[model samples]
Structure formats: structure tokens, C-alpha cells
Target: MAVDNATVVYFSEQVVILISCGLSFLGSLLIICTYILWPDLRSTPRKLLVFLSVSDFLSASSYAYGVWMVFKSDSVDCVVQGAISTFANTCSFFWTVAIAIYLYIFLVKSNRRLADSWVLYFHVVSWGIPLGITIAAVALGRIGYDASEVSVGWCWVRIQATDHVLWILLTGKIWEFLAYLILPILYILIKKHIHRAHAALSEYRPILARNPQSQSPSSMADLKLTFIPIIFISLRIWSTIRFLLMLVNSPVRQNPVLVTLHGIGNTFQGAANCIMFVLFTQPIRSRLMTLLCFCCHPSRDTAGDGHAPSQRGQGAETPFLAEDTP
Candidate 1:
């Protein structure tokens, strides 16, 4: 009777999470489609837009696993959903940190060329390092079984939270949360300062207002990107709250409802960053529209199937004048 009741509750929560994941996924796809199809959107905001779209896609993928296994319950096969859940969560955090670091280097570094090199390094480390760590974690978990098995719906390794293992995992968790949540807050403060400085400079030379789209921290589209980390932070908060309550009394270390919610929430965090970039950023939207028109309505759309930079340079050069004589 107790097992039966647990199953029923699991069934119901899974359904809710599935629906939520679907909605978030569809929304993310539409937004990405918009950004990719437009050229004006991609030129200046290209790198950042790419980051958001990738984040959203990963989020959607993570959510899809939950809907497939959790809500449907024992009816479906359970793969490494726990591992995936762990990977996606860690990845989403890292991506946000990448964006923040990118913004920081761009705003602070006087030499654009050196900062550009650092940006490439950031991308490699951001993308490459997390997977290595996760593999180590999962291997560690499997070498010595933490618990009976990996959790029912989760894709990653589910180890028994030994005092030592928990401490190590918690250390990583602290860094993840700080890098995503705390560093972004710092970025905002720094951005606010830079914006003020830019505003002051504009007073002296009006032409400074017509700066490169890439230089500005908050573009017309970037406001959306800026708001998304805040949502991810909220997800962490909800997870933390439920976790604290569950921690004190429970030995099993599992709650179907909370687990379902956290999985869905984390996925949404990944997808939201990308979708928000597409929907909220003007450059992405415009570029995507143009790209779409070129593909679907080639006659109507004049943007040829060429590279992103050349087109962007042409579009951008109009705003600034040629070099002056010494």
C-alpha cells in the first residue's frame, strides 16, 4: 500500500513536470529559430546569442528525459537520467559564468586584442572542464556504490551521501552557485558602473554613443540575457529550501515531488537563457528573421548565404567615419 501510494504521487508529479518541460522546450526552439534566421541579429550579438541558444537547447534536452521516465514511472525504461541531470545542471551554471567572465574582460581590458584571446580560452575551459569533472564524479560514485542504485528518473550517478563524498560534492556545488549567481551580481554592478562611465563620455563626444554593438554590456537584446541568471538563481533557492527541510529528518535522501521540480527547473534554466536571447535581443531576432526569409522566402529576403562577419562589417561601418590625417 505504501509503495503503491508513492508510485501514484510520482506518476502525478511526473506528468506536471513533463508538461512544463514541453512548454519550455517549444518556447526555446521558437526563440532560437528567430535568432538564427536573422542576420542583423547575429553579426554583433553572434557569440552571445550562440551561448544562449546552446544553453536553452541543453535545458530542453534535460527536461525531455524527466518527462519520459519520471511521470510515466515504471512503465518506461530508466537510463542515466541522474547523470544527465547532474551534467546539465553543472553545464548551465558554467555557461552563465562564461558569459559573466566575457562581459568582465570586455569591459575592463584596455587591449581588445588580448581580451579577445582570453575570450577564446574562456570558451574552451568553460566547455571542456565540466565534463571531465562530471566523469570523475560519476566514476567515483560507481566505484563504491553510494546507495542501492541511481535514482529512478535521474540520469547521473546517485551515490549515498557519505560525509566525505557529500563534503566534496558540496564544495563543487558552492563553486557552481557562486560562479553563476554571485559572479553575475558582480557583473551587473560593474556593468552599471561602465554604463555610467559611457554616459559621461557620451557627454564629451556624442560619437561615443555610436559604439560597436559588441562593446555594450546591455544590448537591446542583452537585457533578456541579463535577466535569465536571476531565474536560475531562483531555481537554486527553491532546491536549497526543499533540501534543508528534507535533510533534517530523512535518511532516504529522496523526494519525488522535489526531485521532479528540480529537474524541470534546471532544464528550464538552460533553455530560458537561449530563448530569452532570441526573444529579447533585437540583433538576434532581426538576423534570424532575415536568415529564415533567405531560406524559406529567398525571393523576399536579400541576405545572401555568405559569412556573418562580412555582412556585419558592412552594416556596422556606416555608423563610424574613416580614419583622419595626423
Candidate 2:
């Protein structure tokens, strides 16, 4: 029994997608639960991260829906999958941008907290924009958005019409290009600002050390915090590059190994965020552990009460989210 390469690749892609969906679903769910149960994680400064987590949660769920649709294929299901996945994925991208902007303003530009009203602006831009784009694109697809084709495995933006460039531009390439441009610039600026701040703190370490209560927060911690966006952009860029390569060289898509790797990187996008938030963040991990212990011992009277830092430079109170710019 000689299985064709196409058959092997198709099966491998499905398996990889299923694994990615499971990892993303559980990982995002744990993050959501950790945030919901821990009141300390719900401060105003952390609202962006909370919003981002919600977006990732939806994205993961959408991926699962896409997988289900593969089993029960229909024209309506294809359209619905495209609409839902596009909207959710777009929100995730915008949320990441919002976080980057928030970090830049709070960490590099000024010490002041973002006004509470700013959250309204973030939600409007992040959610509202995606809603509009998804509606327009899906509506147009119904009327023959040529590049908006659905695969049996999943529904995503793919070029079906080599002659009609408009659909390809609107589908995903433009947004991906914007991401490629914005993320690198932000990353460089953030790293530079952090390094400069660390040097300034070192110069005054002796003075700060004399007052144990007022010691400067660890720059290394801040550096580690910046790695979240770095890793995110890196993973996304890798997937995007492979996608572009596949578009140009369709034969490469038949390679099961490359296809599997691409599925693992792209489909598990939410899982990456979960690992960063739960594993890399000390405050969240501590809170999560306490919650688990309480669940295990229902009679334990000690419900761990703690405060997370609302802003940078708060001694001994590191952020449970992404605020690491002391």
C-alpha cells in the first residue's frame, strides 16, 4: 500500500491542527480562569492584557470550530468559519499592537498611567475595526470575493484568482505587512529604552540600596517582560513567511514536514501567550498556585490576599500582567 504524498501531507496537517487546537484551548482557558478568579489581576493598568487574553480565548475557540467544520463540511460552514476566524484573528493582532503601544507610552515615554478613558478607545479600535473588516470581507465573499477560498481542512485567506489582486490585498496580506513593519520598530525602541533606563538605575544603585524599602526594581525582569512581544512577532513572522512561500511555490505545500511545522506555529498562537503569562510571570504563577491549593483543600481558610503593582517602580509588587518597566 503506497500512500501518496498529498494524502500523507493532508493527514499530517489535520493531526497537527488538532494538537494545536487542544493546546491553545486549554492554555487560553487556564489564563482566563486565572484572571477571573484572581481579583488582583484586574487592575486598570492590566486591562489591555485582560482584553488581549479574551481575544486569544476567542481565537482558540474559533480554531476548534474550524476543526469541527472540517469533519462536517458545508458551504455555509465554510463561510461561517472564515468570518469567525478572520474576526478573532484580527482582534488578536490589534490587541498585541495595543499592548505594545501601552508599554511604550508607560515605560519609555512617561511614568503616568493610561487614563481609564483610554480603555474605551482601545476597545473601540481593537474590536470595532475587526468587526467591520470581517463583515465587509465575508459579505463580499458571498458575492464572489475571488481570493476568499475555503479549503476542506480549514478556511483562511487564500488567493484563488491570480488576476484579481483586490481580494488578496483585503484578505490578509496587507494586515500581515503592517504587522511586519510595526513590530520590529517597536521592539528596537523598547529594548533601547530599557537598556538606557537600566544604566541610569545602576548609576544610583548605591543611594537606592541604602533605603531597602525603595530599591529599584530589577531591569532584568523588565527585559524578560519585553520578550513576550518579541516571541509573538517572531512566531507570527515565521508563519507568514512560510505562507508567502507556499503561495509562490505551491509544490512546497505538499511537504508534510513543513506543513506540520507551519500548523504547529500558527495554530498554537494563543498557547504561546498563555505560556508567557502563566509561566514567565511570577505574580500570576503565585496566584494560580494559591488558587489550585485552595481548590485541593476546600476547608483551607487562607485565601491568599495580595496586591499586584498598578504601575512601574512599586517596590516588591511586580505586575501579574505585562507591566514590567520600573
Candidate 3:
């Protein structure tokens, strides 16, 4: 009776996960489609949008097989959890690294480079490197793979008490720390130096009076534009920590509470980085709104009437009149 009840719960969780995944995927698709159909947006967050789409794709694809196993347990053959989890975690790690590196280069290098083939090369290396390491770890006889009644969601790999899963986990935890912590801090510190320089310039000019050295048009081109990447980096670090906690030694795995938290947290990370971050930006959001309004009302897009807003127009107005003798 207990076993049957557990299966039922697992099934319910799978349904919830699938629905969330589908919605998240739709959001990614919309962003990608906007880029495909529109030319203006191509200059904004283009590389970022690509990286995010790829990450969500791998993460979602890996989990789908695991979700399937919950419904048809026997259909899961060899360590599906191991394989899928491998892809998800790797993309989570490697791709996060790639983004950090890309951002840092964009900031310090002074020239943004975009080419059609760049995305293709990025996909190959980012996907290939971690995949090779994952396969090697299993094949080297260092880590064993098997399915256990411990969880239905894990189709490919689940580490038992004796499985030394914690050992493999600890190594990853260390590497993840290097990728998630040190690199972001370095980027922020470098950004601070640049910010300080710009703030100094604001002293000599009125346009920058309130805040001259806009973090935008510098390290970040727009405050609204930059917010998404900042959020992505923050979430990447957060998810890395949660992943470490979910490893073999975690007693939380046995808790219904931990299991649900793990599933929800993972899903949330995947969805936010792909959807909310991409769509909430100034350019992307503008394009998305235009697309939606055009599809529905068709005649209702007045977002870019080609006039700057009143406040900006006022800011541009000069206070210098034909002055009395200085």
C-alpha cells in the first residue's frame, strides 16, 4: 500500500513538472522567434538569448526522459537519471561559465563581436566538453550507475548509501564554486573600477548630474537592459549551491519536503533564466509586446511612435539662454 501511494505521488509530480517545462519552452520559443522575425532586436541581447535558449533546451530535454520513466517505470532502461541529470547539471555549469566569460569579455575587450558561426562553435564546445567528462567518469569504473526504488524521477542514476556518490559530488561542488563564485566576483570588481571612472566624469557634466556614469552604455548598456544578465548570474550561483545540497549524503532526499523543494527549485531556475530574464529586458520586452499586440489587435502597436518621451525631451532642452554678461 505504501509503495502504491508513492508511485501515485511521483506521477502527480511528473505532471506538474511537464506543464511547467512546456510553458517555459514556449517562452523560449517566443524569444527565439522574435529574433528570427525582427531585425532591430538582433543587436540587443542576441548572444545572450542564444545561450539561454540552448541551456533551457538541454535542461528540459534531459528531464523529459526522467519524467517519462515515472509513468512507465520499466521503459527506463539504463541510468536515465544519470544521463539526463548529467546533461542538465553540465549545461547548468558549463554554460554558466560560458556566459560569465562572454560577459567579462564584452566588458573589458571594448568591442562586441557577433558572427553567425560564433553560436555554432559555442554550442559545440560547451556541449561537447562536459559530455566527454561525464561519459568518462562513468566508463572509468569510478562511479557506478543503477536505478533504485529511492525515487522514480531519477531514471538513469541514483547513488545509494554505499555508492560513493558523495565523493563524485564533492569534486563537482569544488569546481562549481570556482565557476559560480570566483568568476562573478571578478567581473563585479572590474565593473566597479569602470563605474568609479564614469562617476567622476558626471562631476564635470550636467547630463550625468544625478548619475552621470550610467552603468548602462558602459559595462551595461541600459539599466533595464543589464538587469536580466545580473539576475541570470545570481540564479546560476544559487542553483549551484542547491545542487550541492541535493547530493548523496543529503538526508533531505528521504524527506518528502526536500524532494519537492529540489524539484521545484530546479524547475524555477530553468524557467526564470530562460523566460523572465530574456523577456523583461527593454528591447526584448518591447519587441515581444509589439508581437503580441500585432497578433491580437493587429493595428494597436504604438510603442515606438518615433518620439522620445516628454521627460527625455525636457532633459534634452537646454537651460542656456542668451546670458547677461559673465
Top candidate on TM-score is 2
RMSD in Å for all candidates: 7.3, 5.7, 9.1
How well does model 3 score by local distance difference test?
0.47
lDDT string for model 1 (1-326, tens) is 12232222366666766676676666666655644554444322245445544655665666467446443222112324444545555655666676565545544443435545766665666566656765766556532212212223433333334443363354246555576556667557645655667545332132334446535555532343356466667655545543454345353335665665554564555345544544443344455566767779768644644434444544221111111000
| 10 residues in a row with least lDDT, candidate 1 | 317-326
Alpha-carbon TM-score of each model against the true structure:
0.66, 0.77, 0.64
lDDT of 2 by residue, 205-303 (tens): 433454465344443344445666577766666456555655565555445566566556556767887777676655566656766777898676366
Q: Higher-TM-score candidate among 1 and 3?
A: 1
Any idea what lDDT model 2 has?
A: 0.58
Find the 10 residues in a row with the least total lDDT in model 2: 143-152
Per-model tally of clashing residue pairs? 23, 0, 9
Query: Candidate 1 lDDT (Cα, whole model)?
Result: 0.48
Question: Each model's C-alpha lDDT?
Answer: 0.48, 0.58, 0.47
- Report the C-alpha displacement of residue 32, candidate 1, in angstroms: 5.9
Whichever of 2 and 3 has more TM-score, that candidate is 2
Q: Across residues 177-198, which tens digit of lDDT does each residue of candidate 3 receive? A: 6665655564565455446555
